[model samples]
Target: MAARERLADDPSITFPGFFDDTAVQTDADGGVVELTGALLRAVEVAADDFLGPQDANTLCVDRHESHRYRVVRRQGIIFIRIDEDPRACGLTVPALHSGAQYAIGSDGRILRRLRDGEPDGSLAPTDAGSGIPVPTSEVGRSFEAPDGAVPLPF
Candidate 1:
């Protein structure tokens, strides 16, 4: 795609997989970030469609302005760095593997809890916090596992 045409997608903002053959980089705060293996796989699958063959498969993440978060590609996978202290939401990075599938949605809190389960050391996820609670208005949000999967509306 031409640069001018691409710019029309969203100028002043670059996203992961924006380029087909370039390593994505983000400059943000250093903090602890976590995700389940499932989520990582989903993202990987998603990238395969947008990124070119020469592009390295990875999502580099860093802090964003106003306490918001951003995701990018690096080393053949996608990543998001959670703020130690979140503003709108109390979302801490959930410890997850880099090889499983996950569901990403606007309601990250609900999705994270569902995918990561509770930190209390339990095998099965708890129903209380199992389902992530996202605003119905964000129902149109789409997501994919780090495995370069297709976009699924949540």
Candidate 2:
């Protein structure tokens, strides 16, 4: 039962070859082959089946060297989320969404077009823990011009 739960949430075990663009094909063996519509449908079906309804919560370890992953299944559709860094570009800025929110299928695939449970933008930036503005230190500038230098008259 645990294995079944992992299969639905873990991308690696859930989808063979992670359903790479040119990974699976039929009508040819041991050689490069063109992807066909039938092959694609097969993969989709495999995913949908493996991700069937599961227990309250499923824990799956990512084999792709990705961050820790968790799944929340509802109505047979699982939402895959990762423990991601909240900062972007390593900048000390507040983003508009939470890092661990994504709409995913029970098959360990993300629903690119779907936005499930909008992220919490209320998260404060790490740099500004208390939401207090931090001021940049101002360095004194050299106001003295070059010795014997004169200003040009316009």
Candidate 3:
């Protein structure tokens, strides 16, 4: 069976086969997808779609100027944290000023969303002073995409 099919059938695996596509090439040594050109653009588009609409009234601030993201697979789930690109914002000190985070299932379904610093109420409280709580399961919360939705490759 294909790797994608095997991943889909294995409930123990949480990382989606989102990057299994013709446009993406995987490195044999580490099995890491080399995202470039069209594939990179597609992933960006997917992230934007997942983020939904933003307020357009800001004067000179471009909310979509750039984004820095971190992806991790742990305990049978994939978590992604996206923050505003500090370098592009020209900040004197490095920091993640604003952004959104979410967890996705192997089926490419978004399980939960944590906007800004607020955690979804269903999440269990972490250790004291650990900041926002981590998601423990699929909460059924999902973003409704428009006509053309791009599949995320991570």
Candidate 4:
């Protein structure tokens, strides 16, 4: 049975429990199980399917008209460096350009936005002006910037 179906059928069965009970066969010697090679790949596939893709870029790409964004995922958050200048393709910091960078959740909600290495005050409100609240725990944490990219100031 598929993992999703198993979870739906049995509310008490966690993902690990489901995997332990059904995903792999135990060794006859001592009932030990090891995840390696094909098994590891299968686990990854199942995880991606169950929890959705880890990268927020796949979720947020459709919202942008340009595909010149660089995505970096760290600690369940996604950082996107948007290249606004058409000539700046493959370049990290466009010269005197007005591109913006964003820290977004895996679910594609904007957490923070930066312009020209500073906080962008012109950010619009979301969810009928209530705006999305930035989680305090997510604030001040340093996310690894993409290669040749400047780190966000948040």
- Predicted model with the maximum TM-score: 3
Better of 2 and 4 by lDDT: 4
Task: Give the per-residue lDDT digits (tens) of candidate 3, residues 1-154.
Answer: 2212222222232332323433322425767565434334333433654444457763222455456556555554565566666567666544444665555554454555555656446545677775776475635656564455766555
Off by over 4 Å in 1: 1-27, 55-154
Give lDDT: candidate 2, residue 31. 73
Residue 154 CA error for candidate 1 (Å)?
46
lDDT scores in order: 0.33, 0.36, 0.49, 0.42
lDDT of 2 at 60: 31
Count residue pairs with overlapping backbones in model 3.
0
Write candidate 1's Cα lDDT for 1-154 as tens digits.
Answer: 3211221111212223323455333343774557566555444332322222332333222122213223443443333322212332344452242111122333221122111132322234557755887899879775543564755456
lDDT by residue for model 4 (20-97), tens: 223333425778665444333333333333234455564332223323444444565454455443342444553554
Q: Write the per-residue lDDT of candidate 2 for residues 49-112, one digit (tens) a residue.
A: 3333334453232111222234334554444343323232343442333223334454434432
State model 1's lDDT.
0.33
TM-score of each: 0.21, 0.22, 0.40, 0.29
Score candidate 2 by TM-score against the native: 0.22
Indicate the residue-level lDDT of 57 in model 1: 36
Q: Give the range where candidate 3 is weakest over 10 consecutive residues by summed lDDT.
A: 2-11
